[model samples]
Target: MAIANESRQEEQNMREEHHGAGRYWLIWVLLLVLTAVTVVTGRIHIPTWGLVLALVVATTKGTLVLLYFMHLIDHRGANRLVFAVSILFVVLMLAIPLVDLGTRYRGATPPGSTVSDMQAIDIGADAMEGRFGGGLRKEGKTGEQSGSPRQ
Candidate 1:
């Protein structure tokens, strides 16, 4: 039928739009150059904008892979819309946890130290003080002497 033939023609046109071996080789070489840039950025510490530059390079590489290798360029608009939405969700997922961690209190507890170490550091009445700074009024409940805090 004419409809079947038209569909085949459209499919052929889509195939033609796909890049040839030369185009792929060019993209591959560009990707290699970007990779070299990434390695150089990793070696030298730029402090402020180092992470930003690395992210930009990574995003560029990802975009190239998606557009060419994934064949998203010749795909439907809906496919691109779906991809964009997914990316937005991924960003939101990473950003929400970062916000939570950023707003939290820093160094509330001693890093990698035990309770015995804390007691050794500050003994007697100071050791009896709780995490929130309230000293124990009555002790010996957990099998210590009639007076004094837990061991």
Candidate 2:
């Protein structure tokens, strides 16, 4: 019984050592502060200032997610480099909207024009039925059947 208890305690100690508590407390506090900032930014419609503040909050969250959750903070050299490259790719992804926005004066479709044709049909179920051609039995009626014991 004593040996079993000692083994259980050792296992618990090992688990604590392996996982640790991390820096989740600080992370959580930062997350909460950022959340508050974001919410406040939305409330005050200063337009110009609000946009900047929102971007700052968003960047903070991105950094936290990348460093903490994604484990990039623990790694050095190549891993960090890749993480940076991935972040750059994300920035490039975000820049696509700005690219389109910059060209907005060139007769681009305005915002909220998601569906160009509102009158588009919704024959989704019909599409499925037509796809199968009423299953294999329909083909049997179409004069094409496999070898049938030719007497």
Give the Cα lDDT of each candidate. 0.70, 0.65
Which residue pairs in candidate 1 collide?
none
The list of candidate 2 runs beyond 4 A from truth reads: 1-22, 49-52, 106-151
User: Candidate 1's residue-wise lDDT over 3-99, tens digit each?
Assistant: 5776576678897775679877888898999999999989998866785688778978988888877777776656688889977886787678756
Q: What C-alpha RMSD separates each model from the true structure? A: 9.3, 15.3
Model 2 Cα lDDT, one tens digit per residue, 39-91: 87798777445655787689889899788766556555566788789878877
Best candidate according to TM-score: 1
Model 1: ten consecutive residues of lowest lDDT: 111-120
Q: Which sections of candidate 1 miss by over 4 Å?
A: 1-12, 16-18, 94-151
**Ten residues in sequence with the least summed lDDT for candidate 2:** 131-140
